[model samples]
Each structure stands twice: as structure tokens, then as C-alpha cells.
Target: MPTGTPLAASRSTTERHDMTPSDPGARRAGADTTLVRHLNRRTVLTTLRSHPDITLSTLGSLTGLSRATLSAVLEELTERGLLEEHAPATGGSGRPARRYAFRATAGYVLGLHFTPNQVRAVVTDLEGQVVARERTEVPPSVPAPERLARARALAETATSQAGPVWSVGVATTGVVGPEGRVLRSSQIAGWTGLDLVGTVRGWYGRDAVAGNDGTLAALGEKWQGAARYADDVALILSGRPSGQGIVLGGRAHHGRSGAAAELGRLLQDQTWNAAAVLDEAGRTAQDVFRAASEGEEEASRLAAHLAHHTARAASVLVSVLDPQLVVIAGELTVGGRPFLEAVRLQLETMCINVPAVVLSELGDDAVPLGAARLALDALEEKEYALEG
Candidate 1:
């Protein structure tokens, strides 16, 4: 599991209220007791989610909620089936304090990712544990409509086995519009100007959310991969064509047009296209890496050349963004430590202040997990709105 501050921790703090006697009347006039109760409920629930199997007394100490208020909130949550209480061990003398925990199975969220060749879906419980997953491959020659349908079908199949999906998040390759449409995609055939979110919602019969695959991949790293400890990061996904995702102040930075970090576009050299580079050398990217591993001189030179170009591109981002860490993701990482060392070597020479560079631990699953993380955020928003 990723080891930074959990996403739920930052959101769990209660909003402070003034209790000065001079402003008592004004505060009372502006205050809604119902809103206060909801806030208290959210605080308690979020706290319990982070620290499971905690006694009520411990929760009271952590939240500073009076016993009366804490009891009321816990009771309400328990009644709503959002929390569960378990009895303590019998060895304790007379009576044991009961422990309360978040009911992870209370709801589910769906995460879907669509690429030129495949559609992947994952269903996660409220606590972000995978409950079910499905994947389907679509030939590159398939029409956009058919590809979209297959993706939707895969999502539906995953959701059906995972129970009620409270929220859905979709990640795809392209410049995603504010309204969740794919504005353009060079890799996917006839994918430009498609209403991706609308297609998912239309098929699933519920509102669904969407984001760029690169950005989501960065979020996934934060949530469960190599960048877990870094607040500011740049995730460079290397493949046929590379892409980048930026995280600043512990949040994904989607630029004004949601196309903030299109690193592949910055490269004017042929090295940017892995397929083209491999074709020229009469070897696949994987084959090149394998041969280089076996000490083949030609393959070693090719790997070094690709690393230099990648480092050149990455140095520009590092110089401008100054992120604490840079994560190399996608197909290039298949080369393993040798590829990472080569990139790091070039980066150290080019960069004035070189940040730590490492390979992505999540591989292809990063985007889908990041989408699930987004779905969890959406679920929290919906819950808050309902309570308010």
C-alpha cells in the first residue's frame, strides 16, 4: 500500500466555530444545528475510516467531540449501516469496550480505463479495496462506437458482480473536455469529439465522471505507488508516445484545458516514438531491453540513445516544475533497473537540481486505481451534499 497521508485524513478535520460570548447571539442566529450535526457526523465517520477498530473513548479523545455528541453520531452511523461495532475480547474483566469501524462494504465505486486496444474496469468498496475487475480487448481497427460499447459492457459486468456502484470514474487517453468528452486522441481511431462520460452514463443509467489517463496515472501513484511520499511529483508515462502528469501540493494539476502535461508533444525528435525507434533497429522495445541486458553492444547503444532523449525531455519538465520526484511509468519501465539507471544518469548531468527518479510500481493498473480514487472523492462529495 502507498504510505503517505491518506486522502481521507486531510478531509476529516472539523471546521472550527467561534464560541465567544460577545458573538453568541450572532453565532446562534447564523448557525443551523442540523448543519452542525452533519459536520459532526462527517468528522466522526471520516475519523473512524482512517483508524479502524477504535473504541468510542479513543474516538472522543481524537475528535474532541463530547461523549454525548459522539454517542449520538455513532448511533446514527450505525443505524444507517455505515458503521459496525464489534465486541472486545472476552478476557477483559467485567465488560469490554466495543470498537467501531467503517463499513467498507456499505457502498461501491467503479473505475474504468479505455485505451486504443483495451478497456479495463475495477470495482472498489468505499475503503478502496478491489471487489471485482473486468477487462476486454478491442482491435485497433474497430470503430469508435463499437469500442465504446465494449468498454461500457465491461464496466457493467464488473459492477453487476460488485453490488451497487455509488459513483463511476472513467480514464482515457486524450484531451478531455470540461464536460468529459474526448476532444482528441491520436492513438484511438475516430475517437475525437466523443462524449465518453455520456456514453458510460447512458449505458450504466447513472451519471459517470471522466479524466485524462496520464493525470489519473499520477494520482494512482500517489494513492498506491512509488510517489506515495512525495507531495509534488511529475509522472512521465513512456510508451509508443509518452505523456506526463503533474501533482502539486498533493493534488493532481489539470491545466485550464485539462491538457497540462502532454510531454510527448514537446519532443520534436524521432526518439519520442518508441515504435518508430524499434522499427528502425529491427527490434521491439522489449527485445532491445532484453538484448541490452544480455550485454549486446547495439542494443545497449540504442537504449542509451533513447534514455538520453527521454532525459532531455524530462529535464525541461524538472527545470520548470521543480517537483520533488519524477516517476517513469508505462512500457519503458519493462527495461527495469538498467533503463532507470540510464535515464537517471542523463537526468543528473542535465538537471541543476536533480529530483529522485524511479519506475512506477503499479504498471498499467495505475490509471484505473487513480480513477477509483477519483470515484471515492465523488462519493464523499455526494454524501456530504446529501447530509447538508
Candidate 2:
């Protein structure tokens, strides 16, 4: 899959008629239509989001729904303020069908990134476009509790700027346990066994979730950027100690203990910090990549070594997950073809039978966008929960 095609946009909405219709004594087609309505509405919205300005007939064809059913779905979505209709098409020889689009203000999501050096926040509308963003440096030595406090404060501030945010999501490094505890992450200071979701809930009094940075980046990319059409994607995040986020069947696979894909620590020898070697003198991942670009032989060598290790790790994951595509992002990919080509070469050599690999499209904002998507999803879940 190319990095530009979004997965949600390419989703097939054709109804499956595998189950034969029951007798009139059974549940009515009204019930089935209700399910179909919900499903088709989502499909319509997803399609409009990707295409931005599209016709209703086109939507009907894409969703494989009858024009009547598409009309009903669009009406329901529009009534709920989730979508909007534009003027009927004109000027062409034939009559123009009215176009439909997802309303940018239908809902809001908050994406927050807590890095060791900075706290980055973004607010996105339903279409995943950034509406508000803030980035500020923090003391890397701050205690975990203090850092969380600061992060929460920044989140609230960003939310205020975005106005009427529906939910909040956090992305960080380390292990986000199934129990919602962050265990043994080296991306941020004092972030071990931290109850991230609980902390956000307590602080903001709203729905929230936390995930590993690499995982979140992969999610964001899969949702709106590159690798969108892929059912299985491996995001190899190279920087200080490389890591990976694996998406299988459209959802991130965090594993049993939330430590599923830690690509950084996949070492040939147990005595090395892959991140440290890449970021000599304890520089940020960006600095190391920059050094390599400046023709620093050591930096170039370290970058190559990192790519080699990353490919080896990816091979291990491919052997198990058999991902459809691999996305190489973070500081290293910005090294342009040098880093991406090297990594691809290594992956070909390491896992000759694996899936295609590509560079990320969202750049450094992938994780933050993933966080925002998480926040929106949480908000929707809460709405359903309340209704139930």
C-alpha cells in the first residue's frame, strides 16, 4: 500500500447477504436496516472524509448500498449533525447529484504526547486535521509524578484552546500494560507502572486512554496517513532505542502485557543501548539523524547500524505477525532515501518473504494524531455507554 492511501477510505461497505432472510415470524428487516443504517452511516462519513467533496451517487457506489438506503443513511447522519450536504451538482449536461461531507465540527479529539524533553498537544476535528497545537520543552529530569502533573496541566490548556473537546488521549513510550499501567518506558522520565488512563480521567473528568508512542503513531498513520489500506502494518520507530507498533486487522496489537513490539531492545548482543548509540552524547533522536546528514561518519555508521538492527527486529515480527506492510518512521526516516533504502534493503535480506515497506507520511506528528483519534473514539464510546 502506498503511504498516501488511507485505510478507512478504502473500506468496503458492501452488505453481506450470506445469512438467508428469516421467516416473517423472526426479527423484522427493520432491525436489520437499523444495523445497516448505522454501518452505512459510518461508511459514508469515512468516505466523505477521505474524498472531502464527493457526490451521493459516488458514495452509494463506494458503499455498495442502494441509492435509497444511502439517502436514508445520509439523512440520519445529517440530522445528527455528523454530516452536511452541499448544493446539487450543476453546469454539466446531466443533472448533478448533491454532495455530502463530514462536518468538521461534528466532534473533537485531543492528542497529547509526553516526551522526555517536551509536551506536545494537538486538537483535531472529525477529519483528523489539526485545529490547535502547542509544544513546550520540559525538564527531562522531572519525576514521573511531576511530569504527569505538568502534562495534565498542558492538556487542559490545549483543550481550552480547542474548545469543547469531547475526549482526551495520551501517547508515550514504554509498556502500557493491559491493566492501564505504563511499565518500564524509557522515552519519558519516571514513567514506569504509571496509571495513565486513570491519571487523565481523574485530572480531566472525561473519557481518556493512553498508549505507547510507537503504537499510537502506527494507529494515526493507519487511520489517516500512509499504510491506511493495509490490514497489517508494522511501524518501526527508530530513534533512541528503536521500537515498533504493530497493527493487525486494523487495530493495534498491544499483546497480553502491552509489551508486544518493543523493537528497540531487539539486540544482537544484550550489552548495548541502540538509542544511545544512535544519539551519541545523549542528543535527541533528531540531532543524531541531523549529524548523519552532515556527513558525520560515526553518525552515518550508527544510523546504518540502527537500520540494520531495526530490519532484523522487523524480520522477527514478520515471522510472527506477517504484516502486510512496514512503515519506517521517526528521526531516522527523515534521513531520506539513505535511511529508508537501507532499512528496506535490510528487511528484504532479513525477511525475504515479508510484506512491502514504506516511509511514514505524517512525519513526527503521527503519534499525536493517533492520540487525537483515541480521544475521539473514547468520546464516542462514552456516548454509547451513556445511551446503554
Candidate 3:
């Protein structure tokens, strides 16, 4: 588990509003009531966001809050214009029920995705809809300073058109620890042991959060792409160095050091040279898939080789943490049907349970949309938390 902000980094498994009388509960209750109230407001907001038309009565039941306590928090949030109450439902029962929902336009969020060859940015309203998007080629030899400058410039460009940037979320290809620290990376050359979050905050001076690219991609797929409503899942990104994000019990499992499910650096061959693989541009994993698709015999054999290695890697994942779905993204799987067909066949032969494998439906926007979800999820406004 992460350690920082109570809500984003570490919140108990149960909803925050529920007051449990346990050893941990004693410590929590002994703290400031204001903090608990704030958490309760956020809890209410998340609950309402998930069920848009939830009645006040249902809200209390879901969050395990008493009438008076729920009313107080609801009143505060509504007064702040973060939540809005709707007219009671009429014509169904003897007494109608009053419901509430998040005010979708209460604020704006910015999402940025940093790929090896490109940087994508998007601005979205509170509801996580992409209002604007831009992508730029990353410099060939992307030094850390240059990448930081590019991220800052791109974020400024995107936020310039939005009303106001409430929060910013950045996704990168690496082992990013909680509090936005990069533990390591096999793809981006100089990103290892870097303080990505601090650098971005220094550059933009905005409330920002950074995460592993695949984690954000999975979140985006759950929000606006494929895997919507999926619980146990993995997101596979096929780039120069592929990666996977693990989602268990409907949430990303950010491990103790924040590098729990990083699959890219899973060393398949100790002698495999990263530079040599990148030099043979035609030898990219995607190119191999394309060749096979075009009926080239060599391409077919190499594609099978790639599939076998990939399946073996996936088999490791299944043996440890079995997921329900695996979504393939990036140029490799963008071939859609054929790519999925071959990969699925290969994976089924290796795994214990045959997980549903599919190509990313979010197209090129998968990472950017994922950044958007991360941004919204980090909002101070409580209601945004409720989104499934």
C-alpha cells in the first residue's frame, strides 16, 4: 500500500464514512473530526458518482452513515456547489425520495501520457470526457531535462484552453512509486531513480499525480475504453518494451514500493540486448505481427515465436494473480482482430484459466484517456470518486 494522502495512497478497504469500532478505528476516531468529515464528504461524493440518482436514504445505507451525519456532510458539499440535489421522484410511491448527483462541470482535470516516441495530453471536465487532445513526437534522444521541459510545455498548452486546471495526472512507462517517484524503467533511458512527480510539480506548479502508464491505461479502459465494469484484469501495452497493469478487486494493485505489477522488465532472456532490438526497427513486435498478417512465412514464424514468449510471460502472471480480462494495446495489437486471435490462441495454451483477451478499443487515446481517469480520481472533490 502507498503512504501519502489518506484517500489516494491509503484508505481502508471499506467505505470511509462507515465508523467501525476496532483497534484501528480507535486510532482513527481519536484524530480530528474535521478530517473524518472531509473523508465522509468524499465518500458521499464517490457513492453518488457511482449511482447518479441515488436517494439520500440509499446514500446513508451504502456509506453506513447515520441520518444526521449524512445530512451534515451532504449539506456542506451541496452548499459548496460540488453536489446538487434533484427534485424528489414523483408518481411512484406515497412519499417521493430526494436524490443527489455530482455537478459534472465543477472543475477541470488534465491528463498527460508520456510514451517513448510521443507525448499525448488531454483536458477533460469533471466527468472525464476528453475536451481537447494533442500529441507530439518525443525527441529522439530524450534526456530527462528535455522530457521534463516537453511535459511542462505540453501541459501548459492543454491547460491554456480549459477554464481552470483543477488537477493534473501523468502516466509514464516505468515502475513509478507512490507520491510519483519513478523506481525504474527499461524503455526510457534516463528515467530510472527519477523524481517524476516532483519534477512535474516544479515545472507546472499544479496539483499533479503520476502513475505507471499501464495502470492509467487500465483505468481509462474501465472509464471510457474496453474492460468497462471489469473487475480482475490486466492491461498489456506493446511498445519497444511491453508492460502490463494488474487490476484486482476492481482497483489497481499499487504494490508496497509501487512497482508490484510491472511486467515490461520481466527478463525473458538474460542475454537479450535492448539496444539491438530497437535498432532493427522492422523487427519491432508490431512489425512481426504485420508480417505474419501479410502471410510472410518468416513473419509467421517470428510471430509465433513472439506469441510463445509472450504467452509464457503471461503464464507467469496467471500462476501468481489470475485476472478475468487482458487488454492488448499500442501499435502491436492495434491490428485488432488478427493480432488478438493469434495472441489469444497462444495465451490459452499456456494459462491455467483462459482469460478473455482483446485489443484496446480506445484507439490511440488509451493512455491519454487513462491519464484523464487518474486526474479525475485524484480530485479533491468527493463525488468524482464514485465513478465505477
lDDT (C-alpha, whole model) for all candidates: 0.79, 0.72, 0.70
> lDDT score, residue 140, model 3?
42
Q: Following a full C-alpha superposition, what root-mean-square deviation does model 2 have from the true structure?
A: 7.7
Q: Could you give candidate 1's per-residue lDDT for residues 1-388 as a string of tens digits?
A: 1212122222222433655535766456335554676678789988998899999889999999999999888766765567788888578687788898988876677889888778888888888888888899887779998898788778878888876666788888888876888887878888889888787777655557788888888888988899999999888877743677888887777788778887656676776666667778888779889998999999999888878877877787799999999998887888899899999999999989999999999887888988888778766766565232
Clash numbers, per candidate: 0, 7, 2
- Cα TM-score of candidate 2: 0.74
Cα error, residue 366 of model 1, in Å, equals 0.9
Residue-level error in angstroms, candidate 2, position 114: 1.7
Assess the local accuracy of residue 319 in candidate 2 as a C-alpha lDDT between 0 and 100. 79
In terms of lDDT, model 1 sits at: 0.79
Ranking by TM-score: 1, 3, 2
Clashing pairs in 2: 3-226, 7-228, 174-185, 182-193, 240-275, 241-275, 242-264
Better of 1 and 3 by lDDT: 1
Worst 10 residues of 1 by lDDT: 1-10
Worst 10 residues of 3 by lDDT: 1-10
Candidate 3: how many backbone clashes?
A: 2
Which predicted model would earn the best TM-score?
1
Candidate 3: misplaced stretches above 4 Å? Answer: 1-36, 39-44, 50-75, 84-100, 203-206, 263-266, 270-291, 380-388
Candidate 2 residue-wise lDDT, 1-388, digit = tens: 2221211222223433654446552335545654555566556766887887788778877878898878776665665566677898688887777777777775567898877787888888756778888777787788888887777777777767654555678888788886567888765676786788888777656667888888888888898878899978888776633568988888777788878787544565632345566445565556657898899887777777777876776788887888889888776676677777787888888775868878889877888988887777665544333110
